[model samples]
Target: MSPSRVTYAPVGFGDYHWTVTDDDGRPWFATVSDLEHKEHCGQGAVAALKGLRQAMDTALTLRERDGLRFVVAPVAAADGGPVLPLDDRYALTVFPHVPGRAGEFGQRLSEAERDQVLDLLAELHGRTPPETTPPAAVEPPGLDGVLAALDESEGPWSGGPFAEPARKLLREHEATLRERLAAFETLVARVRGRGAPLVVTHGEPHPGNLILGDEGHLLVDWDTVGLALPERDLALLSDDPAALTRYTELTGRTPDPDALALYRLRWSLLDVAEFVEWFRGEHQRTEDTESAWKGFTDTLEHLATASG
Candidate 1:
């Protein structure tokens, strides 16, 4: 909590935080995620802070290349330019907290809103230097690979002693999920082997990453931006069926069945585990725990049905 730059305090709210000013002064929204950038994880893990700063650089370069001039790092970095600190902490150099009830195009977008998001996402996907391929999937140090390494090794925290119900589902479904993942191993390999058209994508684009700005929208939280199919964003958009329908109308095509399935299973499992973590105080909340539990169970059931 530096006096000069009040981005977020360690003891305060969320992890990936945003400081905004409203009627009662400025407060922040903290998102708990595993993108610890200022500090390294294991030997090769990139820090979240470093990742966001890097993304800021990429985005600004794109904006300028397209002849659009905008501030890069808006708040914690420097003069509104995003930059990494000497200690490895990322900072946004410019911000003016404003007051208002608002929402982002991601949540409930209008036709115009849809256009704005599509444009921004499109810009992100464009302009990667041809040879700049996605970083190779770094297999975890010990296990057979990343997928094989994904586990349900009892999160560090969860609810109290009252027979945490989700645990059973987590166990039962994780086994099922393991099977499902296995079934897709060869297909996943083939898909990657195809050397398909890939681009920088926001691996996750939950509502908080977007903001309503004076010009239109300012997509925030670029931590998870990475190399992936463009449909990754589209798949997330499909999480809102109405949005999906509208988006379909706008784009004049149907969402891919496979991508939807992958996004559903992937997002559902990840969200559910984090919910369990939140139950144990290992994280914070962006959505309800009950909703997560229900969705998680539903997704598992869907997987089971598919497997059957």
Candidate 2:
């Protein structure tokens, strides 16, 4: 498909996006993910690319082999793989643009939407995933970065406009951040020690990745798909007691509160860690950077709130 025009889509976080209009006048969504930002398996661009391929391969299998309709997996490239390495820094993938109302990142699903999502998750959790599926992350990919940032000596960061401000914010919440990290470590130990049944999970089942199309709700962004405890997906609905109960009814497994808290805290710290590295690297004050700055500060506030 030859792209006639490519319009920048300033939607979503972490990855860059564009809407491509092919010669046939069809729309395709293009996602460019920074290989460095993802650290689920290990460090470096190579490991990041491997982890991404594992996840995308699992998604493709689920959709094509397992017959999961809700999963909008990536389109395979010329090499018969979904991932195309754009450069050492970024990777590219394309998907058929689902024309519908997409959900917001932090928005809680409504009752009907929640029920549909829970049902979809139940089916997903019960599936026998492909052998290539990697294990779900016990901790955030960027935990080391977060720890390093917290342990750094008091000095101004030198990435770009947001560097110093990010440093100052980190300093202001140093004690709280430390406490939260300690608490997170404890939760991780508890959750792992329990030996809960692991299944294929959408790491971020939050609203932003759901698109309500003509047929029903379709889940996009399968980058986080991996074998993990069900709570990893259910953590999105932790605040909604009714949803939790409903999920229990559907799956006949009681949701673990400690597990829920563990993932919730993990997400906050992940955001903090990602922004720290972003500001510490070669960055400039573009629209994305500015938005990342707000995300950095907001997540810190969220960590404090969780602590309280």
**Which candidate number would show the highest TM-score if scored against the true structure?**
2
Span of 10 residues, lowest total lDDT, candidate 2: 237-246
lDDT of 1: 0.48
Residue 181 in candidate 1 has what lDDT? 63
Q: Write the per-residue lDDT of candidate 1 for residues 2-39, one digit (tens) a residue.
A: 34334553321123444644455555343333343222
lDDT of 2 by residue, 1-308 (tens): 89999999989877899999999999999999888767764467899899899989999999999999999998999999999998897999999888999999879677878888888898899899789789887778677887788778387688788888888889899999999999999999999999998899988888998999898888898888888889889888665445577787877888888888888888888888778889888788798888888888889898888788
Q: Each candidate: what lDDT? A: 0.48, 0.86
TM-score of 2: 0.92
For model 2 the local lDDT of residue 16 reads 92
Instruction: Report model 1's TM-score to 2 decimal places.
Output: 0.59
> How does each model score on TM-score?
0.59, 0.92
Alpha-carbon deviation at 176 in model 1, angstroms: 3.1
